[model samples]
Target: MVRRAGHLFAFLVVASTANAQMPPPTVGVIQLEAQAVPRSLVEPGRAMASAEVDIRPRVAGVVTEILYQAGRPVEAGDVLFRIEPSTYEADVRAAEADLAAARAAVKEAEAAVVRSERLLGTGTSQSTLDTARSTLEQARATLQSAEVARDLAQIDLERTSITSPITGIPGFAAVSVGDLVAANQADALATVTQLDPIDVEIWAPSARVLSLIEDISLDRVELAESITATLTLETGRAFEARGSMVATSQSVSETTGSRAARFRFENPRHILLPGMFVRADIVLGTANAILVPQSATEREPDGELTAWVVAEGRAVLRSLQEIGTHAHGWIVTEGVAAGELLAVDGLASLTPGLEVRTVPVELDEYGVVHDLRDAVAAGNVEAE
Candidate 1:
């Protein structure tokens, strides 16, 4: 009888151990729903001046003075440099003196002509009168020439005061005081670039942009109203003001297979500068897409993606491809169908083919938990 009791005790101990090892299979499950998302594409681009001009000399002379401070903004017609005006001024004075002399000579010739006319029938000869008249006409022609020379000299003198052709920021002066510069020199004295209302040049894929344009045309969408763009500077900060597409290339580049697109943006604060590397976020169009919560998605050992779903009262795994993110979730491009009961919480204790007690869960508009079952269901579908 004692031997029988020992065997029975051993059997009880083994049964208790087996019961302790077995874990209860239960997991929370929520119905998966597909959400529509809008998409945007980012393209590389660079900022450039909307208007740039070379500050060149109109008339060559010795640099007498520098009118503007280096690296500062200037208004249109603002004097930037001053060439020596002594030579031009001298030429003007000489022309004026020549004009005065011509006037005096004309007066003397007219008087002689009058005298010859009075003596024509007396001792004075006709040739003398003719000579006087010719001299007066010559004097008048000389005066006309001198007047033209004076006007030209004045023009030259005014050009000596070099002024900015456009309102912009002038760069450093290439030449300083007492430096001789030529009028037709290849090099420029300085450069002026417009800072506000800059342009961003982006080379986007030809096929993609063309397709977007065609889609807009087919849908009768307004190009200006439907499209929008923003700039992200090289420092990785987004610009406050938005930009708009102003112009595009007529043909695609054969080498890069992209077409050049120009966008205009207001830079009233002068934050954006020319030759800056930037990123362009172009909103092509909107489309419907399916999104799953990122928390529910798992990365497998093989670098693939997976998620647990409750199928037929057991844990099941489904493969998924997360293309991007949208509305607090991963946008699944493929795998997993709609209306499946996906396990979102308490997944650590569950494995494939394991029985799970599921509790229904709901998500709010912001992807936060809205409502959950108070008690876990005992049976597959009915609450205990």
Candidate 2:
């Protein structure tokens, strides 16, 4: 055993001789900005516009002219299509003529009735007076029939020129020029939707719903009349808009186990549209938290988050407990102390107790590093 210890000491001496020839380690570093953060789950939502309507013709007619272009904006009562008005106009005129003729007959019958009554009092035949009375009643009935016909014909004429009932942007037209459209056509000529003000519908869990209720009931918070939400588009970045919580579904969805919450957004620019898939980030929870750069943490092969900060020129890897995430970094809960020197730049190539060279960085009003400064400021950091 003594001989084995002697050999081990000899090997250690040989290793120390070889280690003395190693060069000093140096690495580039970026200063980390720390701030309050909250750990939250991301929820997805959809874009919705309120003004969606199906345009249907009340009266059937051949399409004579299409006044509005497909996919254009129109005002309420704007002429969209023109049907053959000749038939309806002729009917209206015919009904008017009948009404006038009926009125003339009524006047003639009334005069005869008056004469018959006077003659009866002066000894005219009873049968002659009875015939005059019957003729007057028939004329009055004829006038009533003509009046009903005129009203019906006028309504038909007005319906021949189809106008938009709501003010909005119209979708593709179902019927083009010369396409014969029938009354009670299920397909719409076009769809008009209001987009200046839009709605976003999001599905939230019951727990979040409870929190929202608490905030509202306590009077410590007011529902945001204008909160920013992003819309996912088929092309380009998600559309950004400020919206207010407008409504909530009366009951939770049985299948989804979630509640539907809707917010209204003003989109005067008219960029938003209905049926767009979106993900909205609501700023919530307590703001104060310890934040660090995501890069400073080294993810283990097993996927555990680990961070290495320089402690007295030695790389000290710490297993940290994290809470929330912001644009610049993460909010850590444990395994770190305020004002500790953290290795932000060379975390990838570090192990515990490894020697390192660090350069402190300067930061502006925002936690962004600028020039060399020793002091680290503690403030609220926001996602850029």
Report the number of the highest-lDDT candidate: 1
Best by TM-score: 1
Angstrom error at residue 18, model 2 = 24
Worst 10 residues of 2 by lDDT: 375-384
Question: Candidate 1: TM-score?
Answer: 0.62
Candidate 2, position 315, lDDT:
78
Task: List the candidates' TM-scores in order.
Answer: 0.62, 0.60
RMSD of each: 8.1, 7.9
Per-residue C-alpha lDDT of model 1 across residues 117-193, encoded as one tens digit per residue: 99997978888889888988988888888889888888888999988888888989898899998886789999999
Tens digit per residue, CA lDDT, model 2, 235-295 = 7576666566777788988888788878787787777678877666664443344676775
Q: In candidate 2, which residue ranges exceed 4 Å CA deviation?
A: 1-42, 109-144, 215-240, 283-373, 376-384
What's the lDDT of the predicted structure labeled candidate 1?
0.79
Name model 1 segments beyond 4 Å from true. Answer: 1-39, 95-148, 218-222, 284-384
Candidate 2 root-mean-square deviation in Å? 7.9
